[model samples]
Target chain A: MLKLIIENISKTFKDKQAVTGFSAELSEGVYALLGPNGAGKTTLMRMLADILKPTSGRILLDGKDISIMGDHYRDSLGYLPQEFGLYRNFTAVRFLSYFARLKGLDKQEATTRVDEVLKLVNLQQDRKRKLKTYSGGMKRRLGIALALLNDPKILIVDEPTAGLDPQERVRFRNLLSEIAGDRIVLLSTHIVSDIEYIAKEVLLMRQGTLIQRSTSEQLLDSVKDKVWKCTVEQHALPQLQKHYKVGNIQRVETGIEVRIVSDQQPLADAVNVTPTLEDVYLYFFNEEVIDGVQAGML
Target chain B: MYRQECYKIFSKKSIYLVFITIVLLLVYVHQLPTDMTMRESVFEELEETWGGPVTEEKVERARESMNAADAGEVSNHTFELRATDYVQFLVTGAAMQKQDQSERLTMLEAEMHDFDEGTYEHREAAIEHDMLQALDDVHGFYLIRSWREMFELIEPTTHVLLLSILIFLGLSPVFADEYTNRTTDLILATKHGKTKLVSAKLLASLSYIVIVFLSLQIINSFLNLLKFGGIAGWDAPIQGISSGLDSLSRLSYDGSPYNFDVWQFFLLTIALQLFASIAVGVIVLLLSFLTKNTMITFFVSSIIIATPALLQQLGTTDGFLGYLTDFSFLKLMQVSTLFTQFQAYNLFDYPVLYPYLLFILFAVVTGLLIMLTYRLFRNQQISH
Candidate 1:
C-alpha cells in the first residue's frame, strides 16, 4: 500500500507561524482537515502539495523524502488549491490537454485522458466552451478534473467545495469517496457536511494546532450528552445565544425550538439529543470563541 | 508545453492590435511625396544616360549641360542639372576622403616615432594607422537616393525603442500573469513546472520577440519600398551613398571603417536589432519573475531600455557618461554610429574593436539574466 508520512511539519511566514508541528500518516483513504478561517488548513495542504517548502519538516512518500524525490514525487501527487485561475481563452479540452502535457503525458495519452476527465467531471458537453464562459460551479468541477488527470497516489484538495452548490457539493463528496478506495486523499475543508458521509477521519484544527483526529462516529461520541433541545420564547433567544453555543434554531408555532451544545442542561424541559459533526464543530470552535467574546462584552 | 506557452502569448488580442498600430504608423510615416518621385524619375533617366564608373567624359558632359541650363542654351535641363550636380559631389567627396586618409596616415606614422617600438602607445598608433589604410576607396553611385534615404530611415535608436515596447507588451506577463491570476500554485505543483516548463517559457518568449521584430521590419521595409522605388545601388559603398547630401546627412557615413556596402550595412543593422530584442526580452522576463506584476514589469523594463537614450539626449555624452551611453544596449541597437568611426577599447596592451566588445558584453549579460530568471522562478515560494 502507498503511504505518505508528514513528520513534524511546520511552516512559518515571517513573524506568523501558520502551521506548527503538524504530523500525520495517511494511506488509501480520504482524510478531511477541518479548520475555520485563518486556521492554517490551506498552509498545511500547500505543504503537502509540495508547492510550499515547510520551515522545518520532511514529507515522505513511500519511504523516500518528497523534497529529494522532487518531480518523482510530483508525478504521483495531485493538488487543487483553494483559489486558482485558468487560461481564460482556452477551451475546456485545450486547457486539460495543456495541463496533461505539463504532467508529462504524451500527445496520444493526453488526448485520451482529457476526454476521460472531461466525462468524469460531466464537462464533456461544455468542453468546447472557453474557461472565461464557465460558471463558478463548472470551473470548480474543472478544477477537480484537473486534479485527477494524472491518477495520483496522493491527492490534496484545499476547500474544494467552497463555491459549489449543494447538489454539486454532494456530488463532489461522493466523487472523492469513490476515488479514495485506492489512494490517499487529503481534503481540507471547513464544511462539516461535505465530509460527513465520506471522510475516513476528520482532523480538527484551531489556531494552527490539531485538536482532534477521529472518525465521524467517534467525534460525535465526544460531544454526546452535551447536545440539548429546548423550546424558548423568541425574544429570549438572544440571551441564550450569548450564554451558550447555539446549533440550529427553528421557529415553531409556540415560539422557537433551539438546539444547544453544552456540558450541562440549563432548563427543566431540555432533553438530550444525538450529536452531529456540525454540533462538534460548534462545540470545539464556536463555543470557546463565542464564550470569550460574550464574557468580554459582559 | 512550449507550444502552449506560445499560444498564451500569441493569443492575446493586444498583440494583434499592436501589430496593426505598427503598420498604420509605418504607412503614415512613409507616404511618397510627389516632388521626390519626380526627382527620382529624373535620376533614373540620368542613370540610363550615363551610369557606372564615374568617367571623366560623363563628368564633363554633365557640367556642360548644367552650364547650358544656366546660360539659357538648353530648355528643361533642371532635372538633368540636379542629377549631374549630385554626381559631381560624389566625385569630389571621394577624392577628399582619400586625401584625408593620406594626411592622417602621415600624422600617425610621425607620432609612432616618439614611442618605443614595443610600447603600447606605439602599437596603438600603428594599429590605428593600419586600420585607416585598410579602408577601400569610395566607389561610384547610380540612382542611390532611395537606398540612401532608406538607410537613414532605419535608425537603430528609433527601432530599438519600438522593439522594446513590443517585447514589453508581449512578454512582461510571462511569469507575472500567473501570479496575478492565482495560477502559480497549480503550475508550480506539476511534474515539469520547475524544469521543462521554465525552459518552454523562455523559448516561447524568444520566439515571440523574433516574431515581433520581424513584423516591424517587414512592415517598414514594404512601405518604404512602395514609397521610395527600387533598391538600386545596393552594391555601392556606404561612403559613396552619403556623398552629395547636406552637411548634416553628409557626416552620416563620413569615416566608416568597415568595407560593407549598402546591403551589408542593412543586414548588420538587422542583426543588431535581433541582438537588442533578445537582450530586452531577457531583461523583461527577469523583471516579470521578480515583480510578479505585469504593469510594473512593463514600466520598469521601458525605463531601463530607454535610460541610455534619455541620458544621451540630456547631453551626458562627453566623458565617463559618454562612454557609458555609447557602450549600452541602446547604442548597440542604434548600430550605424558604431560603424561610422573605427573605435577600439584598450584591454591590457591589446585593442579590441568597440562593436565586438559591445556584442560580447551584452551576450554575457543576457546569458546571466536568463540564468537568474530561471533560478528565481524555479525556486519561487508560492506563499500566497
Candidate 2:
C-alpha cells in the first residue's frame, strides 16, 4: 500500500536547471534511474529524500504531501546520499546507534538493529573498529547499513555501488534485489549493467528529462533489430562512428569491429545483433562523445 | 537520547583536555593570595607595633600613636595599620582596591576633613537628606573581617575567564560539526532530527555548564577557606572591612540601603555569576547554530565576553559610565562590585540596583537565546 508520486518536479540552480518538469508514480519494485553525468539523478533523489526542498513540485506519499507529512514521511523513508562522510572518531557500532536514535528507535531496539545491519552488510566483525580505519568499500557498506536501519518502506539510494569493488558491487546488487520485493527502492546509477538483470523497471534520463521508462527486456526490445555489427578499416572508424551510435568497439584480426544502433543497415555486410541495456543506453545518451570516452562509459 | 549526546561529548579527549587545563589554572589562581595571610613574621610585626599580640588595650595604644599630632607624616598616604592577624589580612587586600582608586580616595579623604558648609558630603547630605539619614547611626571605632575580599576580588574574574573559554569550547560544536562532518543529510532526514535531537544536544551542553560551574564553585570556596582562613566573620556587616571608608562605620553609601552582610552579598553574587556564565554558553551555542562554523562562533563569542571588562577599564568607573558597566555581562563576574552600595540605576522607571538588575537581564536574555538556538538549528537547510 506504499506509493510515492512526484509530479512536475523541477529544480533550478542559480543559472541552470538541474531537473525540469519530471514526474513519476512509484509503488514497490527496484526502479533504476539510469543516466549520464549531470543528468539530475542525484537532484531528483535528493528531492525524494526531503533534504532538498523542490523549487516547484509535490512529492506525495500515499496521497499526502510529503512536506506536510514531515516526521511521518521521514519515518518510512531511508536515503543514502551519493557521498557522505562518517564521523571519524566513532566506532561503527556507536555510529549506527547514533543514527538509530535519530530514527526514533529506543536503546534496546537500536542495539539489535545495529547488530542486524552490521551483519547484513558483512561488517559485524568490524563493528567495534573506528570509521577512519574502515576501507572505502567497507564505508560504502556502512552507508548501506545506515540506510537500512529503519527498514524503510521507501528506500532511496544514489550511486550506491560507486566506490565498491566488482565483487562487492555484485553482492550489493543481489542484496538490493532481495530487499526491493516489498519496498519502493529507487536506485540511481550510470552503470547500465548494474541493474540490467536486476531492476524491474529502468528509467532512462538525459539532459534533465526522463526520455524513456520501460521494463529491462522492454528497454532492450525497443532497439531490437536496430543494433548491427559491422567491420571497417581503422582509417574509416571515425567516419563510421559519426554516422551511427557506437556501443562496443574492439580491434579485429582484419578490420576494426564495432556494434552500433541504427534503424537500417549502414553497410551491405552489416548483421543485426541482440541489443544490451548498454547499447540502448548508448543509443539514448551517448550520441555526443566527449574526450574520446562515450557518455555511457563516463 | 540525552545519554547518547552525553556519550558524544564525554568520549572526546579534546573536551577532557580543556577541562583539565582549566582545573589546573584554577588551582594556581586560587593559590595566589596565600602569602598575604597571617604569617608568623606579620603577627610579630603587629606585636612590635603595639608592644604585644594585639588585644583591645594594645590596639587602642597603636591607634593613639598613629593619630597623635606628633606622629610622623605618613606621606599623605593612608598606610596600613597593625590590625589583628585576621583583620590585617583583610586590610592589606582591601588596600589593592584603594590603590586602583588612589586619586579619588585621596580627594574623598581630603573632602571628609574639610567639613566646610560647601563640602561635597555636606552638600550631598543636604540635597538627599532622606537617602543620607541612615548615616546618623554610622559611627566610630571600626571592626574588620576577611569579607571574602581575597577570593571575591580575584577568583570571580578568573572563574569567568576560564568558564567562558570552557563554555565556548563545549558548545561551539553543538550544531556546527554536522556541517563539517557532512552528517547533515542523514540527520535532516531522520524523524527526530530537527526537534528531539537538537533538544538533546542543548541539554547536554547546559548540563556540562551547570556541572562545571558547581564544581568550580565548591573548589574555589574550599581553596579560599584554606588560603585566607575561614570566613568566621562572614556574617559581619559590609562596613566591617569596607575600603575607602570615611569613618569607622561608614561603608559605601550606595550599598547602605541593602544592609546585606558580606556572606549574603557573596551568595547573591554567586547566583548572578552562575546565571551569566550559563548565558554565555547559550550565546556560543546560538552563534554556532547560525554560522555553522565553530571557529567563527568562538572568536565572536570571546569578543562579546571580553568587551565589557575592557570598556569598564577604559571608560570612567564613577558617573553614568560606571553605572552602565553594572548592566554588562562581564561586570557581574567581578563579585566585589555587588558590595558597592554607591550606584543605582533608573531601569523601567523603577530604581533597580546592581546584581539584582543583572540577574533579571541575564535570565531574560538566556531564555531568548535558548529559543533562538532551537529555531535556527531546526530550520536551517542542509543544501550543501
Candidate 3:
C-alpha cells in the first residue's frame, strides 16, 4: 500500500512560525485537515505537496525523503492550491492536456487522460470553452480534474470547495469519496459537512500545531453531552450565548432554539443533544467565538 | 512539451503587436534617400558598359564618356555625372586610400616605438600593422557602389534595440507568469515540472529569438536591396569602395583590418548580431527568473540592455565606462566598429580581437545565466 509519512514538519516565515511540529502518516483514505484561518493548514499542505520545504524535519514517501525524490515523488502526486489561477486563454481540454504533459503523460495518454478527467468532472460539454469563461464552480471542478489527470496516488487539495455551491460541494465531496479508494487524499477545508461522511480521520490544527487527530465519530463523541438545546426569549439569547458556545440558532414561534456547547447545562430546560462535526469543531475552537457565537456558524 | 512552451510564447497577441511595431520601425528607419536611389540606378546603368576591372584603360573610357556628355554627345546628364564620379573614384579614390593607409601605418609604427616591447600598447600597434599589411594583396577596385551602399547600411543598432524590446517583453513572463498566475504549486507537483519544463521554456525562448532575429534580418536585407537598387560586386574587396555620404563615411570598410570581401563582411555582421541578440535573450530569461514580476523584469532588463548603448552615445568611450561599453551587447551588435580598425585586448601579453572576446564573453555569460535561471526557477518555493 502507498504511504506518505509527514514527519515533524515545521515552517517559519521570518518572525512567525506558520506550521509548528506537525506530523502525520497518511494512507489509503480521505484525511480532512480542519482549522481556522492562519492555523497553517495551507502551509502544512504546501509542504506536503513538496512546493515548500519545511524549516525543520523531513517528509518521506515510503521511507524516501520527498525532497530528495524530487520529480520522482511528484510523479505520483497531485495538488490543488487554495487560491489557484488558470490560464484564461486556454480551453479546458488544452489546460488539462498541458498539465498532463507536465505530469509525464505521453501524447496519446495525455489526450486520453484529458478526455477522461474532463468527463469525470462533468465538464466535457464545456471543454472547448476558454477558462476565462468558466464559472466559479466550473473552474473549481476543472481544478480537481487537473489534479486527477494523472490518477495520482497522493492527492492534496486545499480549500477545494471554497467557491463551489452546495450542490457542487456535495458533488465534489462524493467525487473525493469515490476516488479515495487505495489512494491518500489529504483534504483541507473549513466546511465540516464536506468531510463528515467521507473523512476516515479529521485533523484539527490551531496556531500552526496539529492539536487533534480522530475520526468524525470519535470527534463527535468528545463533544457528546457537551452540546445542549433550549429555547429562550430573543432578548435573553444574548445572556445565554455569553455563558456557552452557541452554534446554530433558529427562529421559532415560541422563542429562539439555540444549540450550545458547554461542559454543563446552561439552562434548567436545556436538553442534551447529539453532537455533529460542526459542534465538535465549535467545542475545539470555542475560543474563536465572538459575542457568544461562533464566527463562521454552520 | 517543447511545442507547448513555444505555443505559450507564440500564442500571445502581444508578441504579434511587437512584431508589427518592429516591421514599422524597420521601414521608417531604413528609408533610402531619393537621390541615393537615383545614383544607385545610374551606377547600375553605367556598369553595363564600364563594369570591367578598374584599370587605366577603364579610367580613360569613363573620362571619354564624361567629356562626351559635356560636348552634348551623351544624352543623359545623369549618366555624365555618374561617369565623372566613377573616374574620380577609380583614380583619385584608390590613390587617396593608399596614401591614407600608408600614413596611418607610419603613425601607428611611430607610436609603437614609444611603448615598451612587451606592453599592450606595443602589441596593439603590431596587430594593426599586421592588419594594414594584409591590404597589400587587394586585387583591384571595381564598380562596387551597390555593395558599398549595402555594407554602409548594415547598421545593427536599431535592429538590436528592437530585438531587445521583443525579447524583454516576450520572455519576461516566461517564469514570472507561473508565479503570478499561482500555477507554480500545480506545475511543481508534476513529474517533469522541475527538469524538462525548464529546458522546454529555454529552448522555446531561444527558438523565438532566432526566428525573430531572422525576420528582422530578412526585412532589413529586403529594404537594403530596395534602397541600393541591387547587391552587386559580392566578390569585391571591402577596401575597394567608400560612400560619399557623410553619415556613412565612417562605415567605409576601405581601411578595415579584416580582408573580407563584401559578402563575407555582410555575413559576419549578421552572425555577430544574432549572437548578441541571443545573449541578450538569455540575460532576459535570468531576469525573469529572479524577479517574478513581469513589469519589474522588463523594466530592469531594459535598463541593463540599454545602458551600454546610452553610455556610448553620451561619449563614454575613454575610461572605465568605455572599457565596459567595448564589451557590451551594444558594442557587439555594432559589428562595423569592431572590424573598421584593428581592435584587441591584451591577455597575458597576448592580443585578442574584439570579435573573439565578444563571442567568448557572451557565450560564458549565456551559459552561466542559463544555469542560474534553471536553478532558481527549479528550486523556488511556491509559498505565495
Q: Judged by DockQ, which candidate is best?
A: 3
The CAPRI category of model 2 is medium
The positional error of residue B308 in candidate 3, measured at the CA in angstroms, is 2.2
lDDT per residue (tens digit) for residues A1-298 in model 2 = 8789999899888888888989999999899999888888988988898888788988999899998998889999889998888888889998999999999898899999999999989999999999999999999999999999999999999999988999989988999889999999999987778999889899888777888889999989998988999888899888887777877888989878989888889889999999998888887776545434655577
Better of 2 and 3 by TM-score: 3
The global C-alpha lDDT for each of the candidates, from Candidate 1 onward, is 0.80, 0.72, 0.80
Q: Using alpha carbons, what is the TM-score of model 3? A: 0.91
Query: Interface RMSD of every candidate?
Result: 0.8, 1.3, 1.0
List model 3 lDDT by residue over A140-183, tens digit each: 89999999999999999999999998887988899899999989
Candidate 1's docking class is medium
| Model 2 stretches with alpha carbons more than 4 Å out | A238-244, A262-268, A287-298, B32-35, B38-62, B68-81, B85-157, B238-257, B310-328, B332-339, B342-344
Point out the worst 10-residue segment of candidate 2 chain B by lDDT. Answer: B245-254
The digit string of per-residue lDDT tens for model 2 on B1-384 reads 687677766666777798777767656765653324432244445534432122444445444554552365432232243334334333333333333333444554455556566544644333233333333322112232234443342445665687787788778887778777888888888888878887899889878888877776776667656655555545454444444321112234222434555577667766766677777888888888777898999899888777767776787666766656666667756655565554444555444455566777778888998988777766665555
Worst 10 residues of 1 chain A by lDDT: A285-294
Per TM-score, what order, best first? 1, 3, 2
Models 1 onward score TM values of 0.92, 0.81, 0.91
Candidate with maximal TM-score: 1
